[model samples]
Target: MSTAVATATPTARPTSRRRRRIGSTEIVYLALVGILVVAGVLVAMGGGNLFSTANTAYMLTQTSLLGFVAIGQTFVILCRSLDLSVGYVVALCSIVGATTMAGDPSRVWLGVVAALAAAAGIGLVNGLVVTKLRVNAFIATLGVGLIVKGYLDTQFKGPAGDVPSSFQMFGYTRVGPVPISTIVMLVVAAVGIVLLTRTRQGYHMFAVGGNVDVARLSGIRADRTVIIAHVLCSTCAGIAGLLIAARFGTGNALVYSYGLDLDSIAAVVLGGTLLLGGRGSVAGTVGGVLILAVLDTVFNVLDVDPFFKDVLRGVVIIAAVALYARRQIDPASSRARFRSNRRRDPVRSGARPDPTTTDGGASA
Candidate 1:
């Protein structure tokens, strides 16, 4: 009777362990979502008028620029690459746009075209450096950023030109109470989501980011994917620059240079994308941008020191990275231990051990 009972429960151990793993994953996901909701509520309760139509519009408009850049950073970061050139790209594009369209509002589209081209060109250089020259993405993009900034300084000699009224209109205009910039952001975000979730290339991007060597062996053209990611990142940076210039009505080359990259990275990481790459969502990135915008508004309304805002941002980034690291580390460790134990167990090695087997099988 004892032997029969043991046989009947042979697979229970493995089954229970698998169940534990699924449960753990679910808990982590729920916890993250809950944190976001709670944070949002706290901000609202702390004098942030998140529900006011005007404030909502302002928030959306403000987030649009950073949100676009954050979306691009999401892809690049997921591919385990960093683009420090983002700020420089924004500076250069805004300079070019402002200078070219200074006198003629009708020619603003020309400036836009030129800015996009320049951005793509910068991206191409970055890709070539990383993929062909074997330079690390961090160093390559940082060097490119410095070079671009130098050129911008030489050309602009300090924010000399004003953005055309037409461009400013695009940045400041409202469409039935919705800011045009916000509308544009939503469209871009929607496009990004579609490209990431629906296209075959999107899957390839994810695979390459997840494991480059494996992706290369699987014939996924990882190099092309990296190049494409850089291009997209630069393009987003260009758009951000244009928006900022239009919003302020002047191309302030140095003012935005420092904060642009940091804000984009913060927003992307805060939105739930892994710093190490291969796991993130556009929706998360958007949420992250909104979170930052809300924080900025709340701090301003509450008359908090500007310095404290920076400190809070730093804390959030650290917390996010730590959480992601723990998740990655714990799961891998558990799986490794499970594999090692299985290897040492002769009975579990040969047959499909029953899930109920109680031969020291560890629970996840």
Candidate 2:
């Protein structure tokens, strides 16, 4: 028994270390921390004052806007769906909300309702098309986005209608140097974290994304999960549109400069959310959003060309996806690889393999 215990102790340490090393969330956390450090260094070298109160405020505000959209996208993607229509929904909602306000502070709530309703409606349509009609998500949302874009073009050629002062205040008001929008964003994210980490519905979403057949067999309503995710996604977009309109004090169908649709997806993906779904965290998504905002600010300060910024963004997205994919190793394959490597080690060459290693490694 003493010898058996001694043997087991050596095995446990390597197994624990191996598990820690391969853990997807752990890897993502480390990567995020490293990226933030690098970003800080770059910002400092670029002559950007990231630590200044004003710059910190600006960063949080910008991050807040993008963060909402990305938060929405995170849910949708976690359910193994995409929402290409979010950008157009943002544009359309901005127009509807702004136009409804028509400079009346009292009627701002009316615009808010209309905007959110429209966004939710769009989400429902996308969900129906994908789940009921058996349409591909990418195609369904893209078609919806195109329809929204066409409607936007016909409705207005440029910025139209005024945003109410009350709405503007909601967007711009600060609490001891922190923008109200940023505060709202933090609240939204906190709610999201709770929803995903602590709720039954959130678990079902992950189950559905992990495997639709398995989810159904387990009595989960896969389609309903998808629909709910899309609704939340579009609703978030609506909220973001409202904030954007308030920030600009006007409505423009072409308001988002970096293409909120793709940017949000990029942020979600960069934050360690699997594009294939079933994995991610709100905190990771927030980290990803901040990284992007930091890079955008630094590039602007360095006078980088707009075209180069686009290229760099594309490269970053691709790299992030690739790195994420690398960490998604199959347990069976990992165990097999470990055994094969063990066989090649000189000290372990003639040793009888521990039968428990495969199961333990795979579980890890």
Per-candidate TM-score against the hidden true structure: 0.80, 0.84
Please give the range of 10 consecutive residues that has the lowest summed lDDT in model 1.
1-10
For each candidate in the order shown, give its overall lDDT on alpha carbons. Answer: 0.78, 0.84
lDDT string for model 1 (267-305, tens) is 887777777777777777887787777667556655779
- Give the poorly placed runs of model 2, Cα more than 4 Å off: 1-19, 22-33, 46-48, 330-364
* lDDT, candidate 1, at 338: 93
TM-score of 2: 0.84
In the predicted model 2, the residue pairs found to clash are: none
Error of 1 at 20 (Å): 11
RMSD (CA, Å), each prediction:
6.5, 7.3
Candidate 2 residue lDDT tens string, 1-364: 2222222334332433334455545555677567667766877887776557776677788898899899999998999999998888888888888899999989988999999999999999999999999999999999988988888888789998789898899788998768999888889999999999899999998888889899999999999999999999999999998988898788878864448998999999888898888888888898888778767766765678999998998887788788777767667768878886875673676776665543333322
